[model samples]
Target: MKIDLDRSKEPSLREQICAGIAERIRSGLLQPGEQLPSVRQLAQDLGVSLMTAVQAYGLLEKRGLVESVQGRGTFVRERAIATEASGDPFGWQLAIGDYLPRASFWSQSAVRLPPEILDLATASIHHSLLPLPLLEASIQSALKQAPQSLGRYAPFQGDPEFLAVVAGYLQRQGLSLSTHQLIITNGTQQGIDLFARTFLGPNDVLAMEAPAFSGAIDAFRLSHGHIVPVPVDREGIRLEILEDLSLQMRIKAIYVVPTYQNPTGSVMSLQRRKALIDFAVAAGALILEDEPHRELTLADKGTGRLPPPLKALDPDGRVVYLKGFSKFLFPGLRLGVLAADGALYRRLLAAKSIVDLGSPLWLQKALVPFFQNPQLPRYIDRLNSILLQRSRQVADTLSRRLSPAIRWQRPQGGMHLWVTLPPFLDADSLLPEAHRRGIHFLPGSIFYPGEPESNHLRICWTNLADAELPGALECLCDVLNEAVR
Candidate 1:
């Protein structure tokens, strides 16, 4: 008669029975080899049909966490090894082609949030951090001095003067690409979608970092592309597996976050970057270089931050460089830039037009004045300093008090450190308890598009106040301990 119930989710009768038994086992109410009710008895007891109970047993069998024997009753399986095999590394439901459920309760992540909450799920972007005032002034000036072109549709190419301004900025960064070579989009996601749709055919395999950003997965799902997951080590996307996938699976392209990768907060080393570039070139696969968290880093005890980007290293247009101001500038403004060879990009422009009439000309124009704002550099320097201090605070505090049972790596530049603890801790189960305690988290599972490990979590400290870190960590640790118990 022992059972636990799911009150909120309207699970199918089979899942309800499975949930009841799993919860009991998780809480130690059921011991190893403890007999479960016969399917008929379970169905009658739960007011469900016999078929429901049979299906429930089938699910538990598939999980390998329970046993069903002929001429005997079902029993709770041992909890050591047979219970440990389930994982969705790519976040797809079963992996061949399933959409990753976006943000769920385990995540507590929102695309946007109220102005008051400290959104540590994303990197820091203080309201006053960017050159907003100066940009506003320049926008007003542009409006006053503008000509008849305001009434006309901008060309398949982006705004002419805006393009010149961006091209000049690129020159300073050693990426010598003409304005015509670039295409402005709503944001990075649009650029990603365009790339996926244009290059990937249905069932065409695309390679991505394992447990990659969920938005990237959603883009691929939209295109119905089959994913080939490439696991990452300290250096970033493991190159040998990447090359192997390219050869064996007919990989269409490789998507990577070369600088300040999301979730893991690991950067690809220069040597790895070069090899990845060479691998892609040899395999004739395009590399999507996503550099959203650009140039944001805390100083190490002795090491300096890495300069230059993958686009800076590419001699050919084999790399499509994706950069967005939304990460550093303002998210609501929705501005992102894509740089590639003009030949490949001309077609992208037409595709863009068919998507959304070329990314809201007015909004792009409103945010364009910052390129001329000399105060821009000063603002960026200050923003980087604040983020650096916050990153250090997170690392230093965690290093001081966290238990040996938990392990973490301090990221040199990004907003978060990916953490791993004893396999018993599931971020999914701990989130509600933490939320009730006024702390929040970005669960590791949310970053993956499919099933993922239970022992990991991502903590982004960039957006929280410096004084808040100690208490938040304490609360988080308590939540973890509670969930495990």
Candidate 2:
């Protein structure tokens, strides 16, 4: 039995060791429950360092591919089947991230755009319009009134006044959460990470809307959650399939962007929201409600109006509200709030404390005066106007030019419009071409939990200026046409 490894290969010996063991498992040389060579023995056989072999074994164990029994040494376990199709895809191919790979690097990608090319990627608020001057003044004022406290770390939980504001904010949403029930996180991403770490374990089901927000899906995948794809149409998650799926799948948690959802601008209909609440109540699963972009929407637009959030309707405290400033507010400011059950907040705050003491006292305090102004919600009207005008320009250009080939919904409030291309094209395949033309749309496949190839794409309206909208849409239409034809 020989393991052929290229010494000069860029992947380190530890990674190579992981790949080697994983390959043998796929080829059936290492059968299920078959004992693996001892770490020391494998180190000697491979002529690599003991640390390298140990790291390799650790990788396999973390991946749920190998198990260690006290006296039995490491043995190949029935490879964790994250995907339960007809047979094991991990057992068959070297396909990376499709179904199985040597190592499950379900890596969350970072999207950072340069100042030159316009970024139509994330549904984020432009920093130039984010009231930075006001925030700076607030921070400086807080610093002046520090009372010898600003220099010290915040009391392990969070800033009191900020938490108070958060509590009040939720109360307005009809949540009635106390300050004790709120946990301040670095951003919405961190709140999501904390939730993912708390409840989900390897291969546990996380039900989500298809063409979902990729950021949340990536978080769940990183947390080792099994992603179950539920379809989403004009009115958020398809309730009929959900009604059927509830009986079959043991859903651990449902992650939803209920209002102005990423990619698709579909808001959950009042009826569907009720069905979801009822289903979750019956299923005994938590609802992770993401309402980051809730404040921005042209409700009076031609697409019509929608209803309130699931958390607003949650009576049993079954819904966990993940609210953040990343969308309508500043993302770089790194501020977000999570509202959970009182006990859960305590646990999560403790968990967060163990992670990083607490969020920056100054930044937390900076958001205070800004949120205090009664004009805050009213300011949303201005943002809606800008986004609405941009959407109109985008819509008209799309209707006049790309009407026949492309299909999309004129999103009532979101920065993005989820559009499906003609069947013959691939969103990912066409993205490189679009990128070359200084246009970027997120591929719909990554938004899918399972490895599903799709022809849909998310177009962010805010990134394009009113004048550039026509030319950009025409160029984009050309790209779509070329990709399909």
Candidate 3:
């Protein structure tokens, strides 16, 4: 019953006491049906507060170690004792039961490929396009400036300097938001999870576009949300379909990628954006607006400027906006910003604190200099130009080589293209042969929540080197041609 307490440790006194007793229980030093000291006795013996002893016992009970009988004493639970004889070590895990959603497609998308394979599946700018030297320099600068940040924990919301930089950055993009309205996430993935956990519950309705970002689909589903798929066309998610859905059920939240949406590359028009805001306001549903590729505008003056984000029109704070830096900029940083206001913002902030406390302090500090640099906008402009050229090259190759039945819209700004194959061909069935030919792609079925459209597949033009893109596209086109023929 003797537990040594370390005063200078990071864990509190209560945590240390729990750990010490829990270890003893697990190691069979404290046997099943054994009655430990009472909370008052333990506090007196250990020279600690009675509250600390009570809290430690409470933690032990939570871990299924002990139980208290009425008017008696606290004794170890019979099932708490570890078995000395073991066969299958991991058999205990089976009792935990499975609650996670099916993530087969999402899992496969992250597999490592051979060097010879032309990777058109991952939606990231080519490594050469990223400012690696700048990133490295920023890291060194961060360490030199704030050496303690490496050893310190960041603020729950974000680093103040980084938050200030993000505020100005968002302001430049026409969204007037203060640092208080923002939470810096590990990435847009984390942002989606935070919002889902904060607002959604079991059987709560979450409306999302069919053929949406797979990550969002997985996140909401993991939260046990009953997802309703709305159709997306040239404009965006069909407003009429969403309105009808609102009538049928109380949707807790709507997730949309309005500008340069993933996989589809469809930008919600200005009119559609306004209607969507109005829909959310009327239905009393929150909108999760994911704008990952908004900054990478590939269109010039000929196609006209793209509309501002859905957040711009959301004066009522009905929208939780996520803007990702991983797509067009440095993916390795895994940096993104989440913007919300009032009560919802507080809820998301609390959820984020539970998730990871905060994103890495070192990375957050490193990003500040990068975001503050005057040349950042120039670098993005150059990156967009190259991506635009690559997109045209991909389009040209497809048009020249593929059958007329195959169709795709060249997106104005985005990392990937959503190409629809002929009805006779399924991207899933075609993927194995594609891999055999040293090419890789993401089949479109993975992007849907319910029944998926197997005829479509997403090809990211940003992954391959400029020199290698032509050959890769040629190889892909040949595969599609042979399939159709």
Q: Which lDDT values do the candidates have, in the order given?
A: 0.70, 0.73, 0.84
Worst 10 residues of 2 by lDDT: 96-105
lDDT of 2 at 355: 79
| Tens digit of per-residue lDDT, candidate 3, span 122-234 | 88888898888777888899999989998999999999999999999999998999999999999999999999988897768999998899878778867866788998998
User: Is 2 or 3 the stronger prediction by TM-score?
Assistant: 3
TM-score for each predicted model, relative to the true structure: 0.75, 0.76, 0.80
Which candidate leads the pack in TM-score? 3
Q: Candidate 2 has what TM-score?
A: 0.76
Estimate, for each residue in 128-210, the C-alpha lDDT of model 2 and write its tens digit: 45667666777777777764556777766679988998788767766677887788888887888788888787757889988
Q: Per-residue lDDT for 264 in model 1?
A: 85
